[model samples]
Target chain A: MRFDLEIKCKKIVGGRTKGKLLLSKKPINFLGMVNTQSGEITNTSNGFERQNLKGKILVFPNSIGSSVGAYTIYSLKSNNVAPNGIICTNNVDITTASGCAISNIPLAFIDNQRYNDLVNCIKILGKNKEIEITLDTEEGKIIID
Target chain B: MHLTRDEEKGLSGEYGEATSAAYRILVAIGEATDAEKLVPIKWAHVSGVNYNTIGDSGLEFLREISKDGKVRVNTSLNPMGFDRENLPELSPEFIEKQFEIARAYEKIGVIPTFSCIPYEILPIPQEGTQVSFAESSAAVLANSHLNIITNKESALSALASALTGKSPYSDLRIDENRSPMVEIVNETDLENELDYGLLGYFTGKTIQKSCTGICNISENTDMWSLKSLAAGIGTSGSCGMFQPKKPSKFIEKVNYGKREMNETRDELNTSEDGQLITFGSPQLGIEEISKIQTLMDGKKFTKPCKIFCPKSVFCKAKQYGIIDSLQKSGVDFISDACTCLTPLINKKNYDSIITNSVKASYYMKTSNKVSVALKSLKSIIKGYTV
Candidate 1:
């Protein structure tokens, strides 16, 4: 099923475009060991075991756990392991928003009525190096490159 | 943005290298919140601790900034995950680095409290009180639980705030931001302090993005239980800030149990007859120490136990003749920052631990796997095992 989804997020800092896309299917926990620089879930539970997102667009449902989660994102950006962009199914969690704002990681929120279906459709999109994320909000539509 | 003359001078790089860094940090934070001007602050808590656990560069940076001893400011410090004095088994180089970092902070007037729960040692600000705090958990707790006004100031901003006694008026300093957006209703009757932790988890899961205040806490709520709940909520959500209903006598009893459970979790054992007792995991206040002394005046300890308290408190107890009385009862009073953080426990050491604080219990679980039975100080002094 093909459908269009759009969202709006406060632009954090932008990063250099790398050639790989590491996407996360499940929601990410801010407290768990996610190597911010490597974009890899280094020491996490079984759910996030072996997940690495270096140079990929991070697609998750939301951020879970800890106010420091926001700072950790910035830490990852500083270390250069941060994702090129982020696309969330819903409104970005506060920590994620703060991190994105602080790190200048491009963010887009997609409003798909059936988010699960859209996630499945976009599953292949995360494997690519360069892809545009169209963010639609009342303010305007911003095409993040 | 309107800045005081000093702030303007600092921003203009008139105050040398370190002050310039502080000024830039404050300006960035102000810009983020769109704050028009910076306000004067009285005290500040600084972060960026360099120890075995932190980055070497961060530690070096802190050392450089703190070397001058010219920074005469009232400042609190964040916790360093690694403690060289406490953990002697670690690497020698790591320990040396930690001592160097500690010395730097001490030179800069940052008391080596090194506790995340600074409110336990530092005084809570009154209503309309403005201070610069960097630790997020403490900031949320102080603002939401204690009704104080503080921003989650950056590490550099906290230093600047301490130097100038002012911060940008934003976020937590504002009144409207402190109000609870979400109200949590306790569906079940919470009996033990652990139940409070579970409830906090539940609230964080249910409330999503909104700030919450938990209502309908049972009359038997204590500091340990509240601290446990707060920590759990903090782990579960971005921040944990809740105001609980005032606790009753029963709640105080539960609080003591939480503390004992925390202290005895790893160091001692509790049989059906033996109760592992703990003191000063939360670093007992003077009032609590006095009360404990009064209760132990003529009591005898039938079981081997440990009393975890601060060096300052232990000295005070020694000065007041309370330490003599405690020693007579076979209770070993140990001066340590955090007993729960200690890795000196064996499986056969104790069957159970009795504690009054919830933070002790929660953190102890990381190293020791034992049953923790929590009770009140009154019960412990009465020679009752919980």
Candidate 2:
């Protein structure tokens, strides 16, 4: 059987979203930190340079950049490389929160323990090893594999 | 949340697609922030003009929104990526797209004031009035100095506010919510602009995410010092607002000794071998420009220097013949845009840049293709003059 685990998280943005998880331990400043076209993390502090954020549930601690970060998130959406969903470990700021809302991206907030456990789930990047995330706002569920 | 009939209709698309979109964002953010209702605003200042920063995706959104949206209140735009007077040498990748972004904003009824220091160009609203402002330095000034209510609006939120002339009534708007959570004591000698700017950095760092009460400020604190100080705080930290302890209505005192201030300054101070000297990160006002003019009265810069400001302030400053002498001294005056945001300055030309603005120092390293060294205005002048 496929590994199925349910994680309790606060649903910030509404709508059902499902994808593989792309996690960042550091908070991102969407403005200069992400390449909207390629969806790669540009901020060095993020520790995952050149990694794409598209088609994944981006997990970060929170936002810590310019106010235009919201627009950067929307740029991803229009460019067709937008993240399926976002999960913040601690809290979401006005910038990211507005970005997720504008682009209709699904966002959820998980506690520190569950976020760490989720991060550990995909620690070793190997072939056929990915943490699949399914977020349903209506049912208020975050099922992970 | 309570919504008036007009607001409900607008949210339901009574006004148009743009207004509907704007209202939806307002309501969503308002609900999320626990704001009770929407409040009308007297002015709105918007950011996100640089094409290099926002990309093609931003232009598309602006084009569509500007075509369909109508701004109900007086709005001022922030600096663009290119100088509007005459296009400076820029990379081919961004030459065309930069002006296109400005066109989109212009189409949407935004006045092409093209400035970050809108508080200088326009009349300051009476105390306790509400406004929706985006630029961090300007928003802090509105809250702390102007006594107006705003919570540092996001680009999208500020645009939405511009479309509808209303913002979510929360944070600084509520008189009760204005209580200071922390106090910052200025025990260090804040002699000049850089010292005050670094003091702001210390204050913001010491009390992250809290309304601040600044203590021991010199009685003769001028607008320029406040501008630099606020710019530093807004650049490094995400503080809501800061006020003098004596003037603040409520806040508990927190000691900010010289040791702590020095430590923070030491951390921010970096030595980088560079050439370009820049001023007007937040777009200097008349006072700061005049000060620079007087300082550089009989001086010439051996190295290349630049000043970024808007047309309004530049014209007002030029009337006194200060800009002419500075230009004669090899200072290039760039108007209607900021240099560090776009391809305005070719990174290959300069090794690094020295600036009095903490905000410019941060962006020069982060977005611009150059290193930054922070220096005081006095030192910068002294180096060039004597």
Candidate 3:
């Protein structure tokens, strides 16, 4: 398939899906920062505050705070409100990896260089336009629009 | 990552649904962390037990996994919401949900110790043994003091380890990563466990390494002080381990002097006084309880005081008549519960709480929404028990 942009990433959890990218510039602590019932980002300090993570490919720098954050991710899935996929711009911490693993959410990690390219593309394309991100594990690439 | 045939089978669902799920989780984490393979672990101390922490979603997953999952290794549990025998005046809904979580873990064949300090009650494996511990304080202690290997596992990863007896051979488990990347020197004179806790909190917040070497700590620092240090670092940052060694020639260096110590103390101590006094965050072992008993010296607490510890420790204390003696002084000994995230101390009933544990203070302020009057155990005993 042809794509406007493709970034190489190390796959943490294997699967393929496409969704609008929801970027979080800061690290997230899912336990308290997210409303598990609705999969809404409750942390007001983060840019994506009050944003529902239901169908977006939630991208973040990292995951921090309590280990219970992993369970919160699982909670998001069990509530039918999890993101289609998660892509970390940095290392995939235990909280993100384990949560994505148990919940079966496709997880991938992009290096700093590729992440910058993705960010610049988003900036040029504008945030108002929906940017579909495809986590193609079989091809080991994150295809973006 | 490469996988053995057995692991491959487990991942492919040949070994059953639960094992397949466990293998999948391990493989995913292993690959993410660049682990070539999985290593066998002897124990797994899992967290995510508190109904307050995990909520309905965690409960749902636990129930589903427990249907076919049984631990392959010796597994212990973290503290639940409240004491099972002496249930607090919580909502019936909470009690029911908490019990459901308990049943799920029990069904999955965990030890159900409901104590975070599993090293205290359980027989610790020989030195250099690998284990998966989700409790932060316990993970720190296992690495720093017990000479065990772990990566400060999350609740789900530890649970997966318990199910499969395997962990990703990366992070802290790698021998090269065990050494400190930074050196934290204590430039201030320490007085009590509270001081040690502050020093640890400072190191944890400042140092950006997997482990650090702490210098100038007395060789004879008590267990309470070490426990406080472990609790402090575990709460403040992601650094899972520390060593009480002198600064090496290489690596970055930071000093934990009075300024840093006072800053940490100010950060955690939010209240002037608290209605309740709690003794444990990493649950009180017999040593701490014995020290408290000695300090109490038959003096009654001026206010409500509770000591959270393991049921095994409580039993031992009772056997030694220490619990009975402490009870006479109006100190409620709560077993199978912890000070952190305990529903027993809530904003509705108590405006604040006093504890020596920075870890407990952090959780009480953030999660429980109650202010904390953090103090040294000695000071608390002297001031409140008179």
lDDT of each: 0.55, 0.77, 0.87
lDDT string for model 1 (A47-133, tens) is: 655767656667676665433455556567667777666666544544565456445666555555545544444565553434454
* DockQ of candidate 2 (2 decimals): 0.47
> Per-candidate RMSD vs. true structure?
7.8, 3.3, 2.9
**Fnat of all models, as shown:** 0.11, 0.42, 0.57
As for DockQ, the candidate ahead, 1 or 2, is: 2
Clashes of each: 37, 0, 0
Interface RMSD against the true structure, candidate 3: 1.7
Candidate 1, residues B52-104: lDDT per residue as tens digits? Answer: 22345445556566644335456887555444344645556766776777777
Regions of candidate 1 where Cα sits further than 4 Å from its true position: A1-9, A12-47, A53-145, B1-14, B27-37, B47-52, B67-73, B79-87, B152-168, B218-222, B245-309, B320-336, B339-386
Instruction: For candidate 2, report its TM-score.
Output: 0.90
Best by DockQ: 3
What lDDT score goes with residue B137 in model 2? 78
Best by TM-score: 3
Best-to-worst TM-score order = 3, 2, 1
| Model 3 DockQ (Cα-based) | 0.53
Candidate 3 clashes between residue pairs 3 or more apart in a chain or in different chains: none
